[model samples]
Target: MKKLLTASAFLTATSLLGMVGNAQAATISALTGYSTMGGASTGMQVRVTFADNTTSTGVWSAVDFYSGAASADGWTLFQSGDTFGNPWTFSNNSSKTISSLFINAIAGSTLFDRTNPNPGTTGSAAGWDFTPVSGSSPTSFTYSNIVNLVGQPAVGDLYAALTINWDSGFSTGSNLSFIADTDSAISVIDPSNPQPVPVPAAFIGIGLAGAFLAKKEISRRQKSHKA
Candidate 1:
């Protein structure tokens, strides 16, 4: 049986800075964890390591990783641990434009294939190639394949679901607010669950709706039992 889990993310920033209108860059950091993976027999992999010391893994595991800060409206900078699992250091001049998005590891980073079981490193174009999807517009861009190559044969047919869902134009939004939205993101207990429902106030309606539905269901059950 699959072990479903839950995750929550919090943004520790009050307001985003000049990451939008100008070329100023900022770093948004977060300590992740408080998630669980599926059973061990399913070739599950670890996705998130939380501050509470609990971890989550799964088949193409759903990890509830978080960003520590908020982002601005325009464009921002974000870097994840590369394929080789090295520590990230923010440089003085390390800023990438929208056109700089690539599949291979960022400069000074190594390439890795998450889908591979015994994955070997390769170039971004060769290993994890990324291309703009067919229906991309000035405001929204979608790429069906975040990673081109699969590391493990078991997950060859499936691909990862990564998204940079911002509410403004990619070319015109602020960088700090963009990362702040990412900071308030969330992950699911199962792959089948709705994704990216963050822990910030942005998603309070979702929580309230879920609670109301659950309460309604409980009241209905009680009335049925009374009969």
Candidate 2:
């Protein structure tokens, strides 16, 4: 009975120690430098970095352009071209025209468009509209809740998409530009519990003292029974 009691106490302490060892880690970052260049591009390159310090590069062609106009009616007017490197360029011919431009996540289906009158038109003279396909356009641009990549981004991850549109015979002098942006790194916690240090020498001494008292009590009871 004494041995069983000691074993039980030891097991309880061990279990608690194990729990202290295990805890979860989380992290996040933003994709930057995704933009459109106005007019025909000789070449372009866009870089994207993940929360884990992983990176991927994208090359764009001429036909791929983004546009912002009075309405969707003007969307069909842009001409498409081939991709060369990172910069998506449009045909330099006088007939080709680009109205607006912006960048979108390659895996993301949502499109953000910026086209409104009044106070909305203030700041960033760049007519480039940021639109999300599903809902209304946002009043400002902000990044949050970034995706968790299983592993570091691969070459074909499609970090972002460059969209461009042009109207025939409308040389409005519209183009897209790529800007470099950086995201803050996130801290991740380990999910596994940390190993607990063995009971200190002092703690062990206390435990032994308790056990001695318990043994003494048992012996005293046994003696009384014999009496």
Candidate 3:
């Protein structure tokens, strides 16, 4: 009986430890965009990276003027040359469950506008924004009504891309990019800082050792009681 109880206690501790190790948070770095124009053509790239070291790349399409439209669905209004809008969405494809979400955006070589003049200017654009959706349980995230760019470019053509990333509790990485054109190559915009993963092997070793000791102690107690 003593040995049985000791072994049971050890097993319980091991189980609890496993549960604690399973509960961890996920992270997403940010999205970066770049564009260049030569003659009458333009090129652009959008890159996104996740916490687990996964990445996604996208190319931007030809520059188009925006049409005056109100923000609706999951899209937000953004403008650069003329008036252009961008809308974004998110989905989870990892085997491991997700605990949280993070997102960031960087504009290279030019800045796009979301409000005011509506029709954004042609210059370097940079900013970061974050919003939590559905507490902790969310499988898909979507944002629409991004930006609508109106007037056409007076000089060279324009291009842009959007990247999205997420973190899932398991050791997995994923990315998605929305490309407008393919002239530009997607590069690592912002690299993520390395993170440590939980070691199940170590936990298992410690648990087995503890269980053995417990069983030994139980056996000794039983012998003493019988004597």
Candidate 4:
């Protein structure tokens, strides 16, 4: 069964989202005006590494910006429909399963809105806010127990259709030059098979020396008994 897990950044109430601009209307928002009226591209990459040291990567590129909109609070609102992309899949070729996942976004990237309604639905649905990491401006998020993608047929680890959109927080005069890019990695770790430790050569030499001494002592005792 598929879990109802979503990854989002800086999520506000949906009611507040009503004030945001709509792509279909192409109108300026109440909070900010349009700055750039050109198309902007957002790129996404998902990489899966199996326990058998095999990897699978998928990439999706789409025009994310219709026109630039400004805001007083430094937030750029993007409706669910504004940054939609097609669904991409990750196939597992390794003999292990996935345990956790991670996501990374560039600086000034605030919101990571993603949604998957039907298991096969490939569009937007939920929202989440990004928290700034210590000693870094860019943001990174980690999630555990994502899915099982190992020890199955080649296509058994296939995922449902999912989509993601990123809304940025920028200062005034910010333009479409600020691209929304994200990279995700999923990996597997097997605790049942721990790496073995190698024995030191000194220990082996010590054991051989002890055996030689015991053999010599036994032969000496036998000679004394044969007197």
Which candidate's lDDT is highest?
A: 3
C-alpha local distance difference test of each model? 0.21, 0.23, 0.25, 0.22
If both were scored by TM-score, which would come out higher, candidate 2 or candidate 3? Answer: 3
Q: Candidate 1 — which residues are off by over 4 angstroms? A: 1-152, 156-167, 170-173, 176-227
lDDT of 1 by residue, 93-199 (tens): 21322321111111111112222221222221111211111111222212222222222222221122222322332232223211100011012112221122222
Best by TM-score: 3
Q: What TM-score, over all chains together, does every model reach? A: 0.20, 0.19, 0.23, 0.21
Q: What's the ranking of the predictions by TM-score, best on top?
A: 3, 4, 1, 2
* Superior by lDDT: candidate 2 or candidate 4: 2
lDDT for residue 41 in candidate 3, whole number 0-100? 20
Error of 3 at 147 (Å): 20
Kindly indicate the candidate among 3 and 4 with the higher TM-score: 3
Compute the lDDT for candidate 4.
Answer: 0.22
lDDT of 4 by residue, 56-146 (tens): 4433233344422211122222212222221112222233443211121111111223211111111112211222111112111222111
> Model 4: runs farther than 4 Å from truth?
1-41, 63-97, 107-227
Lowest lDDT sum, 10 consecutive residues, model 4, at 25-34
Residue-pair clashes per prediction, in order, are: 29, 39, 43, 7
* TM-score of candidate 1 to 2 decimals: 0.20
